[model samples]
Target: MPNTESLNVAVVGTGYVGLGTAVMLAYLGHHVTGIDIDERKIEMLRRGELPIYEPGLADLLHASESRLTWTSDYAAAIPEADVIIVCVGTPPLPNGHPNLRYIAEAARSVAQNLNGKFQVIVNKSTVPVGTGDWVTRILEDNAPDYHANRYAVVSNPEFLREGTALHDSLYPDRIVLGSASQEGIERLRQLYRRLLEQDFTPPEGVPRPAGLARPQFVTTSLNSAEMIKYAANAFLALKISFANEIAGLCERVDADIEEVVHGIGHDQRIGHRFLVAGAGWGGSCFAKDTAALISTGAEYDYDMPILQAAVDVNRHQRQLVVSKLQRHLHRLQGKRVAVLGLAFKPNTDDLRDAPAHDCITRLMELGAQVVVHDPVAMEQARREWSHLSYQEASSAYDAVRGADAVILMTEWQEYHDLDWEQAVASMRRRLVIDTRNVLRQLPSDTVLEQIGRRRVQETHALPMLPVGASSVHV
Candidate 1:
């Protein structure tokens, strides 16, 4: 178990990272105060209503209400806290660089509120490399008598995936704390000792996963810690793009991309995670992070061709889906197109960088009359994409009814179990472009199109395999 020295922690911003950190800390028996500029959201949180949807968040919030407090007033949250975590959003600007204004403001607010007490100001935000140095400079310039070790700036970037933020926080793969100050690092480590060691007994229903390790603890320089986040996200993005690139070749050779990925993924080095070929990646992180990394490289007079290629392939995947639709229907003008799924990926309402949005834009440009349906993303589409004059369908059945063709954009679990019999009965035409390659084996009557698989098979002679490699007795 961790030290019972309860630290009062202030979490700046109430977004996914902030709220998850606040709730997790509070659940760990620490007094936590979550600060956000949005008063309405603060009020909503106080009323036990979450502004966003995350699995298992509400339960944690309700369980830790006694220890957690939400406030817009920074002074109320910052003064008493021994640890201040900056979790503000750093959205990408037009030039593909992350805008650091929010981080700057959060750091400034934290500095101004330092009331003669030592505090470990942790950068929980995913900022550019060297942001720790920037924070230190801001503190020294603003706070009185702020010398070395008076306050420590630790870069503790979050690695939580949306929709599973709560679970990811409690059961992180590793805990990385980067700072120049050894004293501050030890202090923060003690703060997270219990979680780091995985010593806490599971809270009733929250049984620990089998063989889940005590998360590896890495204490590194602040600069390397910032780069780790960018490098990890960029590498994962590359894996998806590389898979999609191979899928295109598979289409040319009449070989199945699924078989190709299966053969390659068996190698221990290349596991089967994110080896999916589809409309490409669309989430809050990948695009912006990749772009920012490329931009950062440019600042150092380096051009990242590999990252650039990955991004290009992702963009082309969306267009490839459109091209397939064109081949089937030929003329898209006045054709009724039913779009299935809207939010970037399943399990969240975040529509930023969603491939479905690009598909909708292109379909509209081709003069296709579009009708859309998503189990959860319709309201998001309506609010953010109100300019698009597309009809709304309550269910998949309603969306496909009288439609010439259907495009499966997001692979929601609900979509996988869709009633194909009813869907076939409702569609005016039989063409279904499943970008996710998820519609396993469609009914014989329906014409299926997948991103990585060829719709038309080319007759080919099979080469003789090694004796044991072949199951056929020829």
Candidate 2:
């Protein structure tokens, strides 16, 4: 089991990925200090107010406030920290490669503050393959007097979804630690021995597998660990884009893509996790990490045509949503459009490369008066896209009320469970676009047209398209 003795750890970055990691580690009996550059965000965290919207995160942060601390001062936190995990963002550059400025700054920040003994510096951010080496080089360059043997750089990329980050962190399928040094690997493994033990209690209400073997901890070289993260996300994104591409074909020949997905998903080898056809995959990880992998491929003189196709398909999926809307009204000008969700996906307020951004922006350019609503992401939407007209509604019904057309952008459960009867009665026209196909129930008056599928305009019935079909008539 992990040593119950106090572990002084500092987690850099307080964004969704960082805060979740810090809070989970703190809950696992570690004294964790969270560091971020934003003063306002630091204040919010200090007051036990989580800036992001992940379920079970705020409760854990509030519960562990004494054991967990927040600070904007990286130098202050680093000295007392035994393990410093870098969780900084690696946003995509204009050239479609990862901009490692934040990662570089974070490494420099850690180097400047290192004065004492051995510390395990773990990179939990999704970065390029060689980042661990680069981070090590930076530390070596800056900390000339610091003992080389006193510190180690490790790669442990996070695989948490923004919405289910806490759950994923607390009960991961596997915890991967990548470092060339055996000592570094052992340090990380010892730190997480609690998770690897048999007698250790699992979190409350989380059912342990009766006969199934407990999750394994995989340790390897830093390069393998980094590649694992990129490979996993890229493959999932590829699956999503592939399903979406199939949905487009299904629309043409009137084949049921849902049934096709069901048939394919049941194939044990092709499990049904990310096979749902939608507008496209978004959020921070998929795009940035995929681009990073492609960049790495370019750097190594290798070809990743599959990843390139996945990126291309995702971009095209957004355009397909816009094209579907254009078909309905012929012109978006002077139309009152209501968007149901603004965040990339449900349960998080991250709007990075969200499909809604493209849909809303295109609608606005066409003169559509767009009214937007999300369960918790409206505030972020308001801040990012101030030029667009956004209305904060109490519910999805309010957003759609009196609108000419409504688009289901983010697949929030509230939108899934919306009172369709009331919504249709309140709307001027019975027009609705299910971009994510979150709605299954049909309203009496509303015309529900799913993206990558044909329009269904009948009472008490919905049309299902066939898979791998031809033609764009839908």
Candidate 3:
């Protein structure tokens, strides 16, 4: 935590997790070189342009001064660094297993470029339990001359939320460092000592959460650390599935899920975090991790029924939105449907496993003309989902304008700031289905429908519908 000699660090891959860590390490006084195979991404970072949408990352990149640099030359960046962190993506395969091609290639590159000096190789991506050993094996195969004493492989899975990654990294809730080599653990710990103890002052845009407790430094076994990442995400995904299941029941019985969640969430044992009833849980972490966990369980001859059910429920959750629309408009063969918020979540431009994209697809299947909008993720949405025929809107209001029915998927703050009076005035049917439960209430001229509740606990005004107007409580 002192202003001692800086260590040389090389981070491979400049995606969300990789870039966030690189910027934070550079600001912590380490000389960091971010290496990637993508020349376009490298050029963007070299020109002080952000390739992804993460808050405070650009500021940290500019504030890092001479500590951080991005390049595509692995030979120049990898061999000389004291520590190399592999942050490449481990995308899920077709059968739910993780395709670790990137991890294998990264190990091959690092081994081929070894400098014959003691160095720490940390795995920051969310991979399987035995991936640490697999990476070490790849190193052994590629760099046969180097002995075990020359390098150490460690599992240091990331727990960053996309929106607040900068703040989360600078002041983490906990730091998990797992390795078989004590020397490797100590070196990584020294690199993270400042963050572990909250030593440095955070940058301008990065705000530490209120009442932030002392960050816990969890030093344990290599495989234990890998399991921690999967377990944490699988549990969060389970909570979301449970909340949606309760919402389904709440709709049929006319009991509000908002009050139910409040009553249960207030208990000390069960806190209110991912307990919101919504279309479904979607993002880079939950679905991918849950599926991989189930696949890994199967490898051990264990059947994870709960986790499997969670996956099934998530698939059904997206379809629930389409069912609501179908119930309202019986013959959905050409309806102007507006979908607000396209990204998996607010504050991220990532559309990986986003529920809104699935909803748009299903609407199109039913012959509905869908229009989409997101404050910052609209461009990414169009690029990712070009196969789907959905017109992109400049703003949330523009999406809702002349829409037969509007569905809210992502809970961006911009979507919450809509002028409901004018927005609903332009709707053709004046029916609003709040999937994320974002809006407090609908306009008096419209009929309101949300995911969980039915006008019992929440103050969402449920006025009598106009004659012949269709409304769905779910």
> How many clashes in each structure?
0, 7, 0
* lDDT top scorer: 3
For model 2, residues 1-474, the per-residue Cα lDDT tens digits are 244655798999988888888887787788899999999999998888988888777777766677888889977899878889999988889777888899999999999898668889999998888889999999988763777677899999887888877667765688898998787888787667665663455555333456645557988888899899999999999999899989989998987678788889999999898998988999898998888888878887999999999999999988887787777667878878888898999988989889999988888788988888889987887788787665677778778777777888898888888767667666666677888876766654457788555555544532222221221111
lDDT of 1: 0.85
Candidates in descending lDDT order: 3, 1, 2
For residues 1-474, what per-residue lDDT tens digits would candidate 3 score against the true structure?
234856899999999999999989999889999999999999999899999998778888998847888888889998889889999998899989888999999899988998888989999999999999999998888874879888999899899999988877888889998899999998998888788777687787876667878789898899999999999999999999999999999999989898999999998788899898898988788988999999998999999999999988889989998887776667778888999888888899999999998898888988998988888898886678889998888788788877888898889887788877668766777777789887885555576678877742233433333334443232
Instruction: List the candidate numbers ranked by TM-score, top first.
Output: 3, 1, 2
Answer with 1 or 3, whichever has the higher TM-score.
3
The candidate, 1 or 3, that scores higher on lDDT is: 3
- Candidate 1, residues 133-232: lDDT per residue as tens digits? 9999999988767877689899887888887676678888988889998878988987787788777766543567888888888889999999988988
TM-score of the candidate numbered 2? 0.92
What TM-score fits each model? 0.93, 0.92, 0.95
Error of 3 at 17 (Å): 0.2
